[model samples]
Target: MTCLFRRIRFVLPTCLAGVLLAGCAPNPEIATVTVPRAAQHVSPAARALLPDPNPPYTPASYQSRSLAAYYGHMQDKLLASGKLRQDTGQGVAITADQLTKDFIDIAMKDEYMRGGSGTMHRSMDSVLRRWEKPIRVFTVFGATVPPTERERANALVASYVNRLARVTGHDIQMTTRENANYYVMFMGEDDRMPFGETLKAAIPEIDPATMNVFKHTPRNQLCVALTFREQNGSPVMGKALAMIRSEHPQILRLSCLHEEMAQALGLPNDSPTARPSIFNDDEEFALLTTHDELLLRILYDRRLKPGMTQEQALPIVRQIAGELVGR
Candidate 1:
């Protein structure tokens, strides 16, 4: 099969969706990014503890129509999981040797489609025509963490931010640093497994020290928020609370602290892949933060409270800024 209908122009930012559609609008238009420090191959005592993947929010772009019926109900659950073979050839053509192997595996049995990425790499590439499908991604982090390594880096940043914000509804920035010590090489083919059997086959009802692989990062005092659509307030939480009131003014604000961040991330915040639920559906509206302040902002679309007017919020502010620092 062969297809190419390139027409994507996402824009969102009308005073951060009027402060999440109802926080009483106003306050947004900040957005910044710069997390770079943590190379030298870690281990100087875990590079003195790591965390800081650029911060200063403004990263939102979720598609709709109920996400095209949730990507055709996840491609009819990977073609009815009969594990491929329903004439795998045509049905979505793509000659040129499958776009130079730029992906082609439509689920069949989902092994993250041979390599990594998910949604079986966009349902084997045929570029998801009409029947609906389009997935985007953005994952970020950083931490050296404190409070005596706060229960294994906040239970590995709350089960890796509830398993990548349930597959990427975007928004979950955490930072904290001094020296550094990062390394999350989860390649593929079970990528050499054993991070306690990959968080117990993706958080099987937690408990294992709340699925701990020797703790990572997590404490508190960090800030940033977003992930609400049709809510009437949220240009990524008015650009992460207007950059935590101008450059992290000792950030501190918590609402759904999920049982005190799962008891300071000792783990088990109802695991089953942790929280968020395998991504998309606008990733169940993302936006989360913590790990000792300064970074992970993200905003735009004027309507910013305290009397709005940043040129009415520069045309849906969004200009890339993902920096989980190092590997």
Candidate 2:
């Protein structure tokens, strides 16, 4: 009976191993083209990106403090150049699908010092692709500010940084391009990779010598626009929403959520504070939008588009330009 029991135990162990091996075979091939990440999912352009995963699970925030440090270094460069003038805000529209797990891995390994941990907001392994629309912010300086008043100029620069932080809920350090004077700060939504990465790749090489076109456009072209006064309530957002719906019906709404300046602008990559801000403890803002803002230049085309002649176009262009000048 002891001999029989030993034989049965050995056979049972061998059978279990065989069963496990049989279950390890590769899955059958399915013909499918890998999805390509196109534009910011938070924009109307978002629909052009890819679909969200079913039974959706919130991804861990992959905000990188290390990258924000690089932003600080870049801001120092712009500030020292004496080119940056007024405090400015800018945002990039990036397709999260463009970000690959491999790219995140490589960046963290090389550029950033994050180890193989969830702390950096990267996925553990390959999975279905998703989309995000993160907005980056920075300060812009005025060209006529005169280079001689360095002290006042720096103070102005700091104020601009504060205003930008207040507007987008990002506490970003400003940076400048090689030839420019102002530092371009960047901030994006939580764990949204391509959005932040896209701006980081662009600002360092921006030619301040060329022109400040961003000065003439909306703060974040990536997001639908909403104008708020110093003391207005969410009802103001309702007006913007009505405009979006009446003027542009085809666009899809992403996040009209208002984010708090005090909370969102503090520490870098703080996921808890990065969510949409509410007036009286709501989950999101009363703000509204359509996905097609990138192509939805309703205001631009209707009021700002230049005509065939330069003279014909200057009025509209200048009017919009003046608004951006913060007058």
Candidate 3:
């Protein structure tokens, strides 16, 4: 058998460490990527249903590390059975060439790796590294969600949670807010101010500016969300706060939810070449594809450690990406 992972001479790019580090007064900079809207999306039918009421108080949620770990193990039993099938994707091929290209494009680039004007050309392995720990997600909704809306969000979450678990192959589980590492939200149209405030309170020692960024939406972002990782004397673990505008069409909101959470898991970049994938700014696929699943698998693979540089992990990534394509 040929040894696929051989040592390579690639050097660690300069900025990746800063993106992954933690400390007070440490650069208040973190990679923030915009999930730009697809070139075009059809608008859903509008209605003037009963107005949504605001919450009496701004709401926030968090989980203890212990419970997050414990329940994550409980979820492993469910995810162990998930199989990424080649035939599950639409218009995507089951070939190694495409898989190799995707792994390199996604795993080795920063979120801003776009070429000048409509072409994606920036390239580097400066994307943040990995989580040394399991992550559990919990869903919360703004007061704007009616019983019917809550049912829709919760049902969608229930299924997406399983997919998240399978992709990470880690202790990625979903339970009530009491023990979640990630707090997913369904925000009402009127809840933007309260929602941003909730985020500022939920993350500790976060930048005032970063927190403030959440308060405003770019013209291109229909449903918006962001993820942050905190380091407690160890490599940081990701916690995401994802929200979809409750008043938007069901399909558009779901697309936002999918991209934000998945991007939070370390593959923070979007590549035009990634086909039938949620990572693309293009709204090509509504669900996770085999290609996307394999990328997540590579990120969480045992051969790659949490803080390893792209150069350090490249060989192992090559091996794992190849295996995912073949198997």
Best by TM-score: 3
Clashing pairs in 3: 115-121
Which one is best on lDDT? 3
lDDT of 1 by residue, 148-263 (tens): 32344345445655543343333333433322111121111111122334322221222343233122211111222211121133111111100111111111111122212211
Q: Candidate 1 regions off by >4 Å?
A: 1-32, 35-38, 43-156, 160-162, 165-327
- Runs in model 3 lying further than 4 Å from the true structure: 1-91, 113-124, 232-235
In candidate 1, how many Å is residue 295 off? 22
Sequence-dependent TM-score of model 3: 0.67
- How much is the lDDT of residue 160 in candidate 1? 53
Model 1: worst 10 consecutive residues (lDDT sum): 125-134
Please provide, for model 3 over 9-69, each residue's C-alpha lDDT reduced to its tens digit, 9 standing for 90 to 100. 1111222210111121122111233222111111222111212322343322232233224
Please state the error at residue 312 of candidate 2 in Å.
4.3
Model 3: lowest-lDDT 10 consecutive positions: 3-12
Query: In lDDT terms, how accurate is model 3?
Result: 0.52
